[model samples]
Target: MAAWGQRLAGVRGVLLDISGVLFDGAEGSGVPIAGSVEAVARLKRSRLKVRFCTNESQKSLGDLVELLQQLGFDISEGEVTAPAPATCLILKERGLRPYLLISDGIRSEFDQIDTSNPNCVVIADAGESFSYQNMNKAFQVLMELENPVLISLGKGRYYKETSGLMLDVGAYVKALEYACGIEAEVVGKPSPEYFKSALQEMGLEAHQAQ
Candidate 1:
């Protein structure tokens, strides 16, 4: 084995970030970053397992994957570990109905989840939907719950777009937490369990992935 191969001898899986990696913040499918499309294709052909992890909550998992494919990246929905799907799993497991304050594009990911008589609040990047009316509704749900639960898809402060940095779910989550005097359970990146879930999906332990 060569020097780089030796260094990666124990590595069984690789995690690639989606946004700002394979694609830029442009509108539509977004422009592919320089050489990223080929890089991803090469990685897919490599021996190491590959997984795309993202904190993106603006679109559904399927939509995101479709966009990547449209950009000429060899990616599929199954190979991507996204926040909305993970958050849905959390919601189902907890049997918690939510007052969802999320993007319209990503709502289909939570179609199976119950929102009737919400006992908790689930928030994400609602874009223009993050109005005072919507925020207040989410806050009201949390306040009514005897035990408040706030589930954030990703605790990202902001993300870059063609227009520049835009606010993410973390900021909104903080606002609700402050008003409700409760903490949120983050379901995406920077959370140990989130990374663990990706590792688990790849059938690789923490040390086995790069």
Candidate 2:
């Protein structure tokens, strides 16, 4: 077989990571990585299909698209793929009400959904909302459900912050899994299906795209 570089020489499409690639989350809102804007512009000019894949479920799709635009990247909402849509789909299909443990800034993403009589606990980067009482409440909700399902947007262990590397939602999700004796259904990066979905959106198969 040819070398990896040779194999990727004919790549027609790209699925790019958001955090730590195009931008860094150290500043909370995110600061563009050096030369990322110009690089993305070059990619756009190349007429190659591109999609921005992010595990950040903290913001709605629209919000993320707007942020990218503000940062000087020529991107559209259609080119963005995040876990929120998948999470919403799973909740609807399973008929499970969400006991959302997400950040206040992004809570509006699920505002339209029915959260009444929650039977499922959905966890994300809750920031200050990851309180002891709230965690206990989520634990209690899981215990009450006959068949509880824990949905984790992403299993990122830690993330870069302005201060330093801080624990991410995955750490909390793991704790809950250990306590509840159940695994969380992860719906973001590192999940092969998620990557495949992004590739599908770009109209390219995994092997055809990077």
Candidate 3:
């Protein structure tokens, strides 16, 4: 297997994370870090495949793409990837249909949302729509279902700058877990499958991007 830094550093296709790598998160504002927009544009001009990946539970691939473009970074829908899409796959495999409590963007990935089912696959993206109503519903579903899957797109205060780390999916996920008394099944980053999918899309083998 190839180490990620080694192989990726030399590849034509480079997958960049939006919040930290491209933009500082503490800026809260949607725009990317100052030079990031231009830096990404320059990479594109070099004929490299650049995919901006984010754990943002709020925006969808299409939405992020548009935002990036407006912020001066050139990108497309197919060039972006989010954990919600992967969460959809995990839910399907479990044969569990969730009364999904998510943003319109997250909900858009699913074919249907069964409101009655107590079982839920919580997908937290820290998006703008994340609210009390949504959290309450998710808690209720977790309380009802003995074991609900809480697939975190990624954990941490992804956005950062000069100040310090901020609250992120981990905080929300932990709060829900404590309130519901049911542990969640997280499926995201450091999850080999997620990395595998990213690598595969870039036309590289698993070890190739180790």
Weakest 10 consecutive residues, lDDT, candidate 3?
22-31
lDDT of 1 by residue, 1-210 (tens): 599888798998899998988888665558888999998888889998999899988898888888888888888888989988888888888899999999899999888999999989989888888999999999999999899999988888888787788888889999999999999999888999999999999999998998
What Cα-based lDDT does every candidate model obtain? 0.89, 0.86, 0.65
Per-residue C-alpha lDDT of model 2 across residues 47-161, encoded as one tens digit per residue: 6788899888777778877878888889898888889887888888888899998887678778767899998999987878899999999999998888879999999998886
lDDT of 3 at 175: 78
**Each prediction's number of clashing residue pairs:** 0, 0, 6
Order of candidates by lDDT, top first? 1, 2, 3
Q: In terms of lDDT, which candidate is strongest?
A: 1
Judged by whole-model lDDT over C-alpha atoms, candidate 2 comes out at: 0.86
Cα misplacement distance, residue 101 of candidate 2 (Å): 0.7
lDDT for model 1, please.
Answer: 0.89
The residue ranges of model 3 lying beyond 4 angstroms of the native Cα positions read 1-12, 24-29, 111-115, 126-133, 158-166, 180-183, 206-210
Ranking by TM-score: 1, 2, 3
lDDT of 1 at 54: 95
Residues 70-123 of candidate 3: C-alpha lDDT, one tens digit per residue: 777777878766777777777777777776656675566666534355466565
TM-score of 2: 0.93
CA RMSD (A), model 3? 4.3
- Tell how far residue 35 is off in model 3, in angstroms: 2.5
Please report the TM-score between candidate 1 and the true structure.
0.95
Q: Give candidate 3's TM-score.
A: 0.76
